[model samples]
Target: MTAHAPPPHAAPNAASERTERWWHRATGYQVYPRSFADSNGDGMGDIPGITSKLGHLSDLGIGFIWLSPVYASPMIDNGYDIADYRNIAPEFGTLDDMDHLIAEARERGIGIVMDLVVNHSSSLHHWFQAARASRDCAQHDYYIWRDPAPDGGPPDDARAAFGGPAWTYCEEVGQYYFHFFSPAQPDLNWQNPALRAEIYDMMRWWLDRGIAGFRMDVISLIGKDVDARIYEEGPDLHPFLQEMHREVLAGRDVLTIGESWSVSIETGLLYCGRDRDELDMVFEFSHIREGWHPELGKFAPKPFDLVAFKRALFSWQDLTRDDGWHALFLSNHDLPRQVSFYADDRAHRRPAAKTLATVLHLLKGTPFVYQGEEIGMTNARFERIDQYRDLETLNHFEEQIAQGVSPEAFLAGANRNSRDHSRTPMQWNAAPHGGFTTGTPWIQANPNFGEVNVEQDMVHSESVFAHYRRLIALRKESDLVTFGHTVQLMQDDPDIIAFERRLGDERLFVIANFTAQDRERELPQGLAGQADCLVWSHTPRGEIPRSLRLVPYESLAWKL
Candidate 1:
């Protein structure tokens, strides 16, 4: 295995370099602030709680902690609906509490990354409020606004991301504004040069505050159609991103990762390509859509496409091989837990979680450990459809109902694919609210707490927690997992996922059984070398099962 040499030059600014360079040789852990830790005892997670946990989090060998969102909002879209880019919500604590978290995290060597909600802003934001007040307001141009059709209404072709028409009628302004998500999240008008400069100023302010970088939200939606029609990116979007490139990011050291969900490899490169100098990388979610029916198209889970997955993964690796970087993740605040979607959840959650972790932690790119993934959290079971709090879930459910789908059938699908699966509070203990808060929670905790809480796993050394610690430790110890080239091995093996990472002469192979079946894979000759199963999330007892037999939900990584 041969390790690629570090880039010829480090990032320009000390702070920018701190965000991107720090990660090149370090580990990152993501926190969905609302469910990470609760300090105010208000049945919600807050800044103080996160600050208090810094020592333990930093001790995990993580170098960066990317917070989802702590911005002020009405909680309509959770914190993604940012009311103010500079202020921390009072519920989560004040700006000082945030400062404390940053200072303390820095003291513990955990750099902070903001969940930059650049694509949209909450309807309550001062800018939006002014826009809603009247078209005469200075902020009227801050968000996308359009005149009603000749028929005196919005265009029927535009569809909201959650469902229904994308244009929301504003009686005050007597016009329709575009929203890719909930109506409360109005898309920002990036075509407005003044607006773009304002957004850039916000970015610079955060960087000047000793923060590391950002996780840009809905990046694909940043630059949109400038003509009468909107909600889709146009040729202007690319050149628009270039404008951002020249003004904001160019040679900065801070890491800029975009959540450009459906972007193709070419589009992704254009957004993060070497010459464009837009972002450090962009997320590709095509493979994440595996296991269901896209024909029905409402966050459906399609079947796993190993070949497609390989091609996509390698495309990202190859495209950015010597140019940019890629941000990897299995789950975040917007999707279902990986263990629930990838592994067997019928009876055994442990093996499935560990096996999933083994595959994710050893992948080629930077591994993003969601708040509870390290402890093996599963999806929450919603008892009633109305009980679902996520706006995305509710909107989709309403859409399915309007489509003439039966309520029961629509909810049945929702149970399997709703974004609510990941919003349930983190399961910390058997106590009420999973020890997340001492009061009534802002949201319900998962009912599986008795079987799946941190306290229980901490006591069992062979628990998923132990496996994750070792997995993270291994990643820290090896440069291959960080920057070496990744190559899949025995990729077509039914129910098995195997990949290799080689740096210099050191080569490591990782294999996992994605199903509950015994499977054996014969390495295609070239990989036959002196190999030892250095780490197995679920390797069997004493004999070391050298023939490559995979148990139900077992995963093994070999050093060759």
Candidate 2:
């Protein structure tokens, strides 16, 4: 098979040539507040807890923190269902606490990127309450609503993402309201000019309070046409995004990333093209979904396919080489732990974690490290269904059990792929409850925390945290790592992932053995030469020989 040639980099415009954004060279770290740290001995993690850990984040050499929602909420979907866009949840802390975090992190050269959840609001939100109470109020149009069907049922049988019908009847207003996820989250009506203005004003509010930017939650769904059943990349998507850019983002030197599960390679640039003025990048799931069962979805995962996964990932590399940008990551709060789900999390966990980090961080994009990821944290092995705190997992358990899926069988799938796996308390040390709290933890800590906590990893020479720090430092110091054109090699090799990054005469080659077995491959003529070792998981190497052999889960990168 012919090797795929690297796409040529687009010529930088006058503006881009003179200046580069901070995010261009810096890596991001995600902090899930409720699991990060506990300040007041509360079972739940709060904003102050995150502040206390700023030193740890700074030590990791991250540029920013993509903070998950700490907004006022009832915790229905873990802060996704916002009751007040401008306030913080009492359990989390106050607005003063949030400002302090932004200030403190900025002092350490870290920006706090807040989560923007505008697609929906909690049923308890004042606007939702007013809309449900009376049809005469202006807030009534703030949400999507429809008259009942002739048969006095929901307008249609559209089911919610969580479970049951998407339409919920509000007896006070005598109309049915639409929700994409749960009835508790009423979909916002973007078609309303006043509602759009409110969202823009709210975004500006956060920006003025000294935030870095926003990681928009399900932003693709904002311009959804519920009446036509067009949710993702609908007709108004680009227009709304452009308007948002012009209204609140044009002058700011901040980064914006949109989260889209339905975005595909064909429409990738529409959301983040340099000229589109929509966003800085997007959190796409095409590569992550490669391991999911086609018919059964994430719950019933298929075996890992390295070839298909490479195709999905490399396509984005090619697409963004000339336009737009990529958001590189393998794990997040919504998915299972990378080491547990994608690689060996048992005996070879450390090496496997390093290999995964090597492949993702070396890619051409902004890399984000999820909390505990740098320490190679594995998934939570919950024996019972009640142990899960995620509404998505619990709701699915109920639906699957009713459909004749045995409790044992569903539990097995949940164990393999559950959001709660990533939501467990961040293991800081070997103390009780993993040093996450002094009281009972909101969720059970992973039993292996004693061996995988950050305190232990930092002291070890070959720890995953050290590997991540080196990778982050390399990106900041090497232009080739930040802007080189990527050329993926060994496309058909199922056991090894190899790629070469080229910028002018400089080249950086990276290779990783993804399996827990010895593997060998012949290097291409262009890749065989003396070079400086940039990063490695096992033994360090000084040159790329014609024939290369890698031990189990070994990874190496060299600059040529």
Candidate 3:
């Protein structure tokens, strides 16, 4: 089936209207441009490649596409370390190519949301370049630059997320600069009103071109403490962000999804203000962080807190009830695939993914599906640490090696944990490089291609791909899946993740076995009236009785 433009008069109810305005009432697929598709056969994925795959998105019932960072960059942070905010990278595509992609998407009733990486710029950015060129330059205040500590050493105890000092010493300016991520990605000086104005002007440029909005990267990091000696935050952060809202996003229909990682709900709501309306929605960091230990960095070493997760979710929902929207997501470009997290139960990839998909889609927040997630992608294995391309991975390898860490063990950890796990060439087919390129791919594709590609699953009715198609289709056709109030039942179940989505008389239960073992649980006491199974990864065959006994990894949706 091909896409035709959505009819202008396709009106929806009030609950859904609220959702539609937040995300255009659409399923958004997140694509990391470098690994999505390769049109030029240059081995690297690019915009023309993504343009070609628009049909795949259309077929999957996607309403909008969130393209992650095609901006001009040094690739230090995989395009997050932007050198130019206004131009597209030569490696990705040209301005005309992106324009055409936008037009074609609109023609297909789909919209575009590009990555908004305003928190920082690549150290090589023109602003940073000029700043480093001279201390007295007009752009010198564009970045956070400081001097040595009172004891005459590097700044106290501020750790770089990737493993070294967060501050990088600059011989040119004879000062230390703040960079929460890699040193190459210098933090922007949002404290400067002049710099904030310029960022908003750039935002206007994209909005004026009819682009829908932005998926802001590390937006919470836009504010940093200026006085704490090491890691202290001052009260001035709110005023600055409020001013940003007034200047950049106010009175516009454009959606703003900020990455409020490391920010509290209080701060999150403040960033996504109600009265002033700073942001439309903000991504809560805790969703994708189920398995992480703070000391372990981004990767997970053990199971996460489900009860804690619920508290985090409900708190945000309550806090933003009358204010901004919430951007609910489980996986994205920066982490390992969901299969890696929930796939311990090898018997139920389809059911588990379907169940997780239901929970995210039916929440009050706007749902986001990462690239390759709909068809159920998993992590890949790497034999050597040197083969990793991610800057953080490389930094960790070097750090571990310096600390006398075992080389074999280091690569093993990197293989199971690196960001590259999600960046591998998307498995399009069983062909070489998983059909991503006729030439050598920029990165190796997962070896499970024969069993995982879209082509194979599209032809099989029982395949995971087909299940995702149905799930997304359900979201498109119903208000419950898009705007309903959510109540997670059996949240305490160690092996099952079950939740209910209700909009007045329309109620549905989404249950998935997170583990492999067949288990039984008494349905939560609150579920009343007759409830019939509506959708399941497997057919609603003889299995889903009134007191359903969910199979291993089986996912089912029941209507009450």
Candidate 4:
């Protein structure tokens, strides 16, 4: 295959020239702190637990670890509702523990990325408490607050991202406060320069403390409408982001990723464009949310149309080829496990897991591996609704039930798509609690842990963990895989996804079967029998066969 030229506007970061900025070729892993491990027999995972697992990360060949929030929180929404931005939650450990983690991770050549939840703060936060005390207080404007409507109802009819009304009346203050999530998570007022400064200062403090960078939570929501009459996309968001880049991220050689919900390709460029000077990259959810129905919510599962999925994926890839960057991931703390959600978990779990990994990791962007994803972990399979511990799941259940959805039906939906499916404790071994904790676990471990634990996979040559390790190593060795432009192929086939990455003389092709049935297809004339197999999920990794045949959930990568 002939090499494709770089995009007309392509301008990769000059900072990428720095040897220390290995993120260009590195794979990042996300660890949900509470579910990663438990070292003190305290039921909850802590910094110490993560420290002990550095060896595992090193073995996996991950370049960085993105930790979910461990800040002091009321535990209202796991840890997203932060009560204090600077200190570690007592349950997790102290500031010293965090410092130790940073030092230890750096020793293993892995950077620690903190989760920044600056969009909102817990209602119990000092700023929120003070704001609620009186309108004359200095912190009054720290959070978004407005007088009740003429009828003493909410400030406006805006809806919360989670559910219900976005405005909550605080009887003590005789006013309503805006929140995109739960009432306990009062939205911060970015309009207040003081609040923005405080947020930047907190971020700098962490970066100065030997930490790598930040994975901003709901960052797009920070710049919302002045009155917040609607849920999103405010007028002043771009200017605020640009100012933040100038004040906080300009000279630092660190990564900055934002969780950009419902963002379009054009808008995404404003955040991560080569010259935008905002975030280093942004996470877009359009492709992943393809299976979701707006009225039914994510809980009510829906099948994704392969053509639609490819359209969204290719659009982002084509648009960002030159201007911006993307964050590639299949699942995270808020989504269901990829194996069960995107692939066949019942009949072809192993191959499906590896196939999914092949499709995502080879994409032209930074790849993220969620906890347990490398070990072929499936859903928690919680039979009773009470077994789930996630606040989103519980709140969603109540909301659905109130909306006339039958309890059994709602629980089934939760079973298929609950955020809790990805929140179960990491399966480290076959021992009780999956060797995650000695005491009662904060949440139940997946029963399949006995067969899917890391211990078993570490010794198996063709295990899911081994496949991921090889993929990471390959990424490090191939510049084409890391920085090449993508050209999708075979778009008409519903059960197959194929794409090529080309850069000069180097060309790489990735193909996957998204179903359980075996299928065969004629190779693209230019690629037919000319490419050598670089990696394969269920086939020999040597050379591409003359006849192309793919088994259930099989995937392969080839280099020409």
Best by TM-score: 2
Candidate number with the higher lDDT (3 or 4): 4
User: Pick by lDDT: which candidate is best?
Assistant: 2
Q: In order, what lDDT does every prediction score?
A: 0.75, 0.90, 0.74, 0.85
Each prediction's total of clashing residue pairs, residues at least 3 apart in sequence or on different chains, is 12, 0, 1, 0
Candidate 2 lDDT over residue span 1-560, tens digit each? 00111223443322233245678778999999999999988799999999999999899999999999999999999999999999999989999999999889888888989999999999999999999999999999999999999999999889898888999999998899999999999999998989999999999999999898999999999888888999878889889999999999997888899999999888899988878889999999999999888976788888899999999999999898767888999989998999998899998999999999999999989999999999999998899988999998889888988888899878878888999999999999999989999999999899998999999999987889989999999988888898888999999999889999888788899999989899989988778888999899988998888999999999999999
lDDT score at residue 469, model 3, on the 0-100 scale: 72
Candidate 3 residue-wise lDDT, 1-560, digit = tens: 01332433323445333334535356778988999999988888999999999999988888778889998998877899999998988989999999999888878778898898877899889999999888999799998878888875776668787879888888898888888888898888887879988998998888777787788787666666744743322366557667777887776666677776666765666666545456777777765565665665553245655566666666666665445667777778777777776464145666666666765666666778888787777788778665678888888778878878788867766655678988988888888888888888777888887787888867876676666677777777777776666776765666777777777778777776655667777766656445576677666743334465767667777777
Every model: Cα RMSD to truth: 4.3, 4.7, 3.3, 4.3
Stretches of model 3 off by over 4 angstroms after superposition: 1-24, 150-152, 229-234, 304-323, 345-347, 525-532, 541-546
Better of 1 and 4 by TM-score: 4
lDDT of 4: 0.85
How close to the true structure is residue 337 of candidate 4, measured as C-alpha lDDT? 91
- lDDT of candidate model 3 versus the reference: 0.74
Instruction: List ranges where model 2 is wrong by over 4 Å.
Output: 1-19
Positional deviation of 162 in candidate 4, in angstroms? 2.3
Residue 284, candidate 4: Cα error in Å is: 0.7
Worst 10 residues of 2 by lDDT: 1-10
